[model samples]
Target: MSLHIVGGLLIKRFGKTGIRSVNLLRFRLAQEFLLCFILTKNTFGKIINKTMSKKPSRFHVDESDLWCKNQCGFYGNTAWKGYCSVCYKSLTNRQQSSSHRVHQHASVEKAVSQRQATPELSYSKFADKRRQQSKTNPVKSLFKSTKKDKSEVDKTSSKGHHHLKSEFGAFLESLSRPIYEDISKRVQNFLSKFKLLPVNSTVETWSDAVQDFYQIITEHINVDPIYQTLEETAVENLQDQLEMYLMNRLYNVVFCPPNSNDEQEDLSLQKRIRSLHWVTIQQLEANVNDQDIGVRIALDKSIADIIELDTKTLPKDKLACIVESSRKIFDAFRLSNEKSEVDGGPQSVASADDFLPLFIFIILKANPPRLKSNINYITRFASPSRLNSGEGGYFFTNMCCVVDFIEKLNAESLNLSEEEFDSYMSGRTTAEGVNTVYVCDGLRLIHENNGMIRRLKERQEKYANSVLNLEHKLSEFREQFDEQINQLVLRAPLTLKPKRGKADIDLDHDIPHSLPSPILPQQISNSQI
Candidate 1:
């Protein structure tokens, strides 16, 4: 029966007892209002306003209030009235107290009683308790530790990170220049490191691109394998541009950096390094089978030369041009691998385009004491192998994910306290070194949204470790070289043992040249489509 009907029936039963009946109706109405109010209000509330009534926190409410309000079966028995569903009928007898009052008027009296307290805790005592509690609670401790560490990384990455270095900042915004000029500097850098090649693909000036292509083809004939394989006059329409690009790459390592610590230099360097690896694997033509040690050495020298950017042999104005030339070679190698990918996934292809920055990749592959900051960078930012598929066909790959992770981690590092930050960076424990005994493990928590990427990264960790070993060896070699000679004397005493080779120039001898490979706009059109 409805409450109103029940009340009316009660009133009819107690017809002569008007005052008591009216009191009963008022009590019942008040109870109903309280119940509805309790249902609508949030189960938990901050102490927003001091209650005139002695209302208990909902925590003390019969546990049903703790159950989600949206669940329709909200109810409690006499012993657990106002409790959550789980605790309602299951409440122990101790939960019920006869002193509990239903009326707000009675609640006000209890509120006054609540103001009295028997105990007071000092600040130091509370702090110690909190510390103890945190130490014991793994979940809370982990959350706090993560937040603290993340904050520190964020603070540093936001402003003071290694990308602030100058050479890096300039590389990002490369200016466009004459194509022939760029090629000259590229050839110059290549010759300085690798033994001299007599002729690279020659460029020709023509009224139109086709004529230019014809002239380029005429120059590289009989020199490169590509030309030798083709019917001499039949492939005459092909051009020298492709040959020119291929020759430049085979000769040297080129590096073009960006103008942004803001763009993240350490990150860019790592990406470039990854690209360099892919280039090594994907770009070397099918025919030229060179030893890895020789190629790696050449790459190391090229990268060192590029980084030095010295202008004694080349004009100072040409320094930027030299770097730009290297960038082109970098781009050319990238493009060639791109071409290789389109050319029927040829088994003959050796060097592939790098997805990472070339110089950075070369440096890392050289395997020396990596720029500590760089290692720190890769550790934090570089995406593992999880970021790619065969779409670009391993062109860009997953290096950028590593870079992005570092950036995110940088943002996250801001929460670490000074001591925590110090420990993270140095892996040092204390004056006694007790805490430092364990290998400091850093975490890279990728966004959950990239679950596939996360799994991919897990697999790449091993390969990355291999690359790190290579880097360490390179670092050791550089250190040994540094110990042998000072910066000013690049060469060791020539008088000690070595003799220079004398070149015998023969006018009648057939000097080999690169074969012509054409870059017809039409070839790409059919392939790209």
Candidate 2:
């Protein structure tokens, strides 16, 4: 039966029961059931309508010609602006070419008009006029020379190309030790105050404090009499030095603050990367491989450099490590491409698309210690100008994007089936039947064995040389001994002496002589008698 009919019957029964509690409860339940049924019916209806209202396939033909409008005899579709894909592309190209031609014509006409409106002077005539002027006004020429020197000086100053060593020396001389000490002391005091705060404080608070201090120091450099003699560029450099000093002092407290989840995030990312150890170069479609020793070395060095970020205490040093690591990756690909060309393979330029996956792979493999904390620290505490632009900024941005990509990675990201990805993630299978963990372990073992073998060979060579030297020394000693024996035989003759008396004989050198003299008095008297 329909829910409406059941609901109506329940309500009618309730009315006939004279407002009994049980009847009222049954009526309420019937109302609730009817309301749910109505909602469910409307929802299903909308779904069916949506499914049925979908537009037909683009290739579905009505009364229109199934061929290209230009009569190219190729299949066409209205979705492609009523043209085949090729024709549409060609049409767009022709339009672009025509527009380019018109633009070039207009630019040429404008250039011709501009040329006609201005007076043209020949190079020789101009040179002659300059020579006559110089001859007529020697003082003017000297003034011009001075002006030219001044202009050159201005250019050099504007370009900020002053000799760094000289400028830095002058800056130090202008701002004496006392001034530098004061600035450092103030910075330390500011940092110490922040250090006294609870660990739960946000990184943004620290960043703002640092930035404000930076502005104050910059203003001081500009207005202080001690810094008045310094050049604008020197003042800027001093500001940079102040920033570095501040960050170095704050590195301990602000970076990976005690209350933040940075360490946990690092661990999670590291675990994720570990699980994805089976990812290979082929899957990433990167222009690198394990077979290329140079590429392998470059990748390994890059990983080492990135991992070294955790050890760096300064933001600038950390940035340098990141840049170095990125450069290694680029160099690896460029060298790989060159090698590929030499080997008769098609050459292609490596772009961000190729760089990203490889970099992501590097991050996954490196699994750098405190990866999240390092990235967050740099992003939050590093100089804003450094992160906003330039090569460092570009590469660091890429690093950030790669990290984010790794965090959000799924089967679709890797272009693998969901089931396959799940299997890999769950450790049920791996790429090419090789687990990444095992591969790393095996490589480490091989490296250790190679080092051991090399050491053993070196020791063997050293011992062999030692044995040869020992043998030569032994022979020399034998020769010297024989020569000495021969010389002794040639130079001296041996003789033996007979003993005159028993007491005189040296039968036992250890015994003393005149032993029985005192006790022999009576014996001597008896012998005499």
Candidate 3:
């Protein structure tokens, strides 16, 4: 029943009651309202509990539905694209294996077919088969012989070392003057265009100008009568020579042009590398024999060679130095490996991973002057074919990568603590109480000291030799002087002449007795005696 209707009926039935009876009726109504509220709350709560119990929970998924679609009897995961992780991995692996097997079977069949197609021969038929093969493969045989002859010719040519004669003899004889003049004219024209407004110049423009210049020169060489008689390699060498000549002339203007920031970058990179001088081979995890004297010498030589890069006038020579330095690093690694092998360790060749860190270390130590400018110059002016492949390109790329790495290097990159790195960079004592000196600084100090000692020793030896030589010369001179004096004495011997007295005067020859005769005061003389 509704609470309002019940309360209204109770109020009507108790309408004639007194204040006490009315108060009791009101109390009964309050109790009835309280009881209704409690019963309704209990019923609603039960209903809600039932509804919630009937609803499915996210955690209680059905097992059959959760099973892998492949029926592998394992639970599936959304992460695995509805397949079990194990089954998914197995499926992928099986697919890969099957594909690999198919490829292998195909390759095997192809090999078998090739083998079956070729006829097997005994010694008896070998000569006949060879004759038939030669008859059938005349061009191939010719190519083989040609290749052999070419290789032999290359070997012979390389054996005869002539700095300028062998490579550019023809050019130097006839083509050099005209070619140089043309290159000079072209360079002059090109420079005229950008010499004044260098800020407007771009690398692309410069590259295009160079490329065009090269093309023109190449055409000129090709059409020249002298070039026709030259061998293909000679022609190529001539072209290379011309390129070098042209680049050397252009290097001053094109390399690190006034508007470019190559110099600034070089200085920045140098400073960064100097800061990272404390990065040891161990920190870089470079595979080098730091303790081996030979390896250390090689690395030091490489550092010196890399430093010489700035001094090289030609890009080729600079590239040669880079290649030499890289080779030295490789040799160092090889030496290390050999030493390790001698110590009963496994032997291995140096790989790119091993090369990079050591190269980085070398750069840090060498800190070549105008490094960025050199790199930029080479990249800009070097033959594309040279820089795209071969040792030059590879090592130059590594050098570039090393520079970049140094630029971006930090404590995290070196796997060092920030505090330690800071201490090293600041040249301060670390927590370990060890002051960090850069590798270059320590090496330079050692080198200077050793050089000083060597020079001092040489000076000492030279001074000793000089003193002995002087003493020997002095002895010879003294003996000569003594002999001359003896000869003089012998030639004009000293004779004792009799002392002439006044009484022994020859009156006619020794004295003019008749010239004048003055009378002496004999009395004064007798008194003085």
Candidate 4:
């Protein structure tokens, strides 16, 4: 107050310069006061501090008890800008149910802002009148009906690219060229048909699944199962689920003797199977069961962890409880080859029949978010190149589709708790929350994807652009043709060049050119005489 009074007095006593100085002092004083108030150990002060710190703050409030969690599942509550700070008076020391409050999370505000910015769909009078005419008009009634053909199955099985069997089907019959909006809508509708695809997914929702898919691939092959039970259905079922999710067809693969391995003849067959997204992973003996100490230790540790964390109360000493394994086979994937290239071919543990199953188990139990981080890290290191050289010498590209499947599953089930899962299984809720079944299917899809990628790469060399010297080739051909023509023209010109010392040789005055050879001896003899 004293400072303000002095400042006022100075301003009143001085000219414009003094007035400017006083105003500057006043602004500084106000700012200093605000800073002091914020750091004053008051809840309201801190809230004000945070609000003032960020841009576009209108009002401030105080909260003593606000906590935020950053689980990525829920759509409505992610913090877009930064932290979520709550201001509470805490009138009563007793706790209150946090869920009851209407306080806005940062994401909520961001969403609201976004929603507000978007324009509403226009409802024009002209468009409305045209729509109304379709209902009332009698002559065009037959054409106006949106009803689809009833006998689709009876119709040719070789229909359009896709069928419009469902009302919400993507392939709507139309004469006009497809626009971007229509394409987007059609994609959404088609994705809707995949029963395994998350029902709640929007058109762009599949994009979010990309990262998760990669994560699944990198780690699934590394996960080992401890139980010597040669193999069990637990992991198999999950791989099957993965296959179903991706709709891959190559979910089962077998590499037999020379003649039996003839399936690679038609490359596109593998692709078609993979498009459906089910594939059985193939392994070669060399990759999985390397006799190196490092390999054994890694596999052993992974299996130990799998058993310890997943199976409850199982004692190691109980020989019958945990049956052990046989032989030199390591039923898991590893970087078996020294290089991506091979003289005969790159060897793998395809013979280890149990490798695929063990790999699947490791994948499902993985912390998905962490797996995503690792897979992405690998991709970053593996920069794009002309030859698809192994960046980290990893074979999980096709395997990554598992991540995509898990993502969809996580998205669908994030709302459920353990109790909810129980209720769901019990049919108290109509939706069954069993995610394990679907995970196995995802594994199958990963294998199929791997096959497809190989096939696609083979075909891409033809269709995909390459730097070629077409212009030079054409130019060379032109030059050769032109040279030949010029030579012919030059000979003709010589025939036309005025016969310098000799009489003009025309067809009528045919000179006896054949006698010149015989005349050599006779003419020489005569000249000598």
Candidate 5:
């Protein structure tokens, strides 16, 4: 059955046939070899087909590229050729995801193109549009439109606006309307009921009336049930309002200024008026010294109590209003040069300018934080010009001296004994006195310095101005000298006149007849000498 053995039998059988049968035997051997090759190829092809027909395991499928390359039983799509349909869809998101990315790119390109086309549009417009489109939802534009509508509605529904002048006018009207008549009447009735008023008391003795009212309230608070209801009365909260009213009236009567066209002057006047109370209170304290010690102490205590109570009790909004109104009024007062003779008997009142710094001091003590923000305003008001001038300078220096004293008073180490603290607060070793020493020392310091710093600053400014003026003068002198030199050079003869000969001088020439004696006129004369 071996090809070699079969071939040997055929050749032996053919050897007897001689040379004529040789060709025929060779052709038959060739046919047999071709048949053997065909059968072997068929058998191998069947085995290979059988092996490939079975599905590969997951491990084999992952490791071998041949299965996918041959498209063996895998049905999944692939992006590449010879891959399954499933793989192609997964790799490309069934091709739609790829189209979606392309679509997004196109949209971005379109937006960019739109932006580029309208180059005149500002960046804000593009930003606004982009912001509107930034939301992923399709309804974002609709929401934006609705939001815009709502904002428009809000704007349209708001209350009408009033200018500062108009508002100030309204406030003046309200103030002028007799708001205190009822309270004044109440005070009168209460005083008459108690028979506390003097036999011939009148509204002119209002201070006495107020004092008596306070004394009665203090005396009867525990003993009388009627007085215990003081807090429940309408007048309970009226004290602050009354105090503010009185202060306003005082400013109006004493320091009210005429209108000015200059805006800056107006602003300063307003600031000073706002600050009037500070100075007025200081003046009041000074006047208190003329009274008996008991009255002085009582007055000071009452003043302190009122101020402290107002600070604690007044609503923030009302306080802000009062402060703003005071500022406007102070601005008017600050520019005022006019002085009115106040009706009070015999005490010479200080000028409003003298009180300005004191007013600021009071503000600092009452509400330090409130003044913190307005420091710039205060500084501008107390600037070099104001400080170098008359009464303002005096007051400003005094205020600074006070500040220096306060700084010193607070200089003691943070760990202070109780007695030391009491002494510090009272401004004396005795517990009865409240810190008068600090104020007294500050006044003493003011007296000692006596506008020294202001004078120094004035000198410094003057020197600076003089230096600038000297520089200008020096420049002018140099310019004038240069001009004179240029004029002298222009006027100098460029060349000497040609010497005149006798015959040449006889010829009609443009020489002057009046020649100097130094020059020989006869030699140049037409006639011989």
Candidate 6:
């Protein structure tokens, strides 16, 4: 308080100009410190006196001088080359040189003469010494002080390189943060809903949940502001990365491979899971289109994963699981049609045509057997038009093309009798000689579609012919009306009246007269008039 009063008095006496004076500021600061020290001097006087009276330990002198300080003219102990920090590099090199000479020559004099004459040998020995120096332990070997320095250089270089790499990786991740966060939020929402279902849920239950989740995902992508804000190339790159991440998440969770177990309940659960997988595939297919290229690519990868995983686990671990894979193909077909009835997906019925055949082709490729059952399945359900066009035909033809290849690579032969072959190709007969296979759903559907196509063509031709006949009738009616009009004009009688300044000519006048008259006979002949 006293120091502040004194500083304020000094500042007030000089006014604002005193604040700008460095000498005044310094004098007042010194005065404040002098006053503070004077007030606290007696309080700390005893402690200061005691601290000043104490002293450090005294140093002792050695009676005999050490070799390092006396001989090497240094201040410390002589552990290496009579000096504390000195190294015996030349001494170690001499030892290595002597060892090499001992191995290469019988006498020291000849060895020295050879080494002197051959400069390459001395240079090689020096290079070897340098290399050994670089490798020697820094703490244990006195001759290798350079090794410590080189090791530190290497460590710093590696650290800097690793830092640059890590910084670059962090930069890339920062650029993709928006896309990553968006996909991560969506995946979390999906997994949250997925967890709501019980572990033993039925295929139908899981299918409904998955369908809803797929709809949400597509809607999120379509309406995302980030997609709208980015350029086309940037959008595609982000989409590629986002889809890879999303597919990875999905493959691990919803579409993960079923665990193998011999329990009956587990087997039943496996069947339900397989069914759910097919439904999920159909759902994915429904959402995939030209505008959804990311989704389409992701779907393809997911399908490949499912196929590879399933193929590795089925039918006694044999790679030939396609021999009896017709049932599952049929199930996918039925599921698609059933879904179509409910308007379950985003795809139209035409878009859904390839779903069954694609998986069928995958199965056949994985395990190539006789093409009989597969051919029947293809010809049965899919119409010729649908099977021959688009992706459907690609897989269909590939299956057929591989048939010859499979035959050439055959390890086992296919055996079938004439009766059996006929039965397999055509419909099977019952004990009553009735062909029960006629009622097969697949065949019936194909027949119905073929009949519909034929009917459509017939109706088109009939419409064209009717249009032609109608045009012909219109022309005939026009001609008949013209003829009737001409007959009316010919049947009517003709007459001529005299003009104001011209003579009248009436052939119907029986009495000839030199003067022309306006009046004439009541009846006039048509030809004369």
**Cand. 1 Cα-lDDT:** 0.35
Instruction: Give the poorly placed runs of model 1, Cα more than 4 Å off.
Output: 1-253, 256-397, 411-419, 430-529
**248-339, model 6: which lDDT tens digit per residue?**
33332223223212134334433332322211222223211312323323333433433443433111122122322323343444454455
In terms of lDDT, model 4 sits at 0.35
RMSD of each: 43.8, 36.0, 38.7, 32.9, 44.7, 38.1
**lDDT values, one for every candidate:** 0.35, 0.67, 0.67, 0.35, 0.39, 0.42
Query: In terms of TM-score, which candidate is strongest?
Result: 2
Candidate 1's error at 351, in angstroms? Answer: 28
Point to the candidate with the largest lDDT.
2
| Selected candidate, larger TM-score, 1 vs 6 | 6
TM-score of 1: 0.16
Instruction: Name the 10 consecutive residues with the lowest summed lDDT in model 5.
Output: 252-261
Q: How do the predictions measure up, each by TM-score?
A: 0.16, 0.49, 0.47, 0.18, 0.18, 0.22
Against the correct fold, how does model 5 do in TM-score?
Answer: 0.18
Worst 10 residues of 2 by lDDT: 136-145
Query: Cα lDDT for residue 237, model 1?
Result: 21
lDDT ranking from best candidate downward: 2, 3, 6, 5, 1, 4
Question: How high is the lDDT of residue 440 in model 2?
Answer: 70
Residue pairs with backbone overlap in model 2:
none
For residues 1-529, write the lDDT of model 4, one tens digit per residue.
6668868787878866788788888888888888886777586754566456433211111111111123222111111111121111121112333543434465688788978896545667668878876555221121121333212212322232233233212222321233224433534443333223432333222322322342343244235332223244533433333322221110011111122212342233223222322111111112333333344444444435433322221111111111221111243234333222233333332331233333433444332222332333223221111002221111232223334433333212333466754554454654322222223447536655766799999888755543245666778999999999999988887445655786565648655787565554434566687
- Ranked by TM-score, the better of candidates 1 and 4 is 4
Backbone Cα, N, C clashes tallied per candidate:
71, 0, 0, 41, 27, 0
Give a tens-digit lDDT track for model 3, residues 80-184: 344543465567568888999999999999999978896655775888878765554221221122456334323333223254334444565565565546544
Error of 1 at 286 (Å): 37
Task: List, residue by residue over 1-529, the lDDT tens digit for candidate 2.
Answer: 8545654676677665554665566678778878887879977776566456432321112323444577765544433354644465568679889999999999999999978896566887899989865554221121123556334323423233245334534554567686766665776577555544433345666665675565567667667787676687776677666555555544655677655678888889889888888887767666564556677778878988998999987677888899999999988887787777689755555666567778887888888899889877876666655654557756676676677777888887777999999998998986872213224747756765776799999999999999999999999999999999999988996676986755667465754475654444444566687
lDDT of 3 at 146: 49
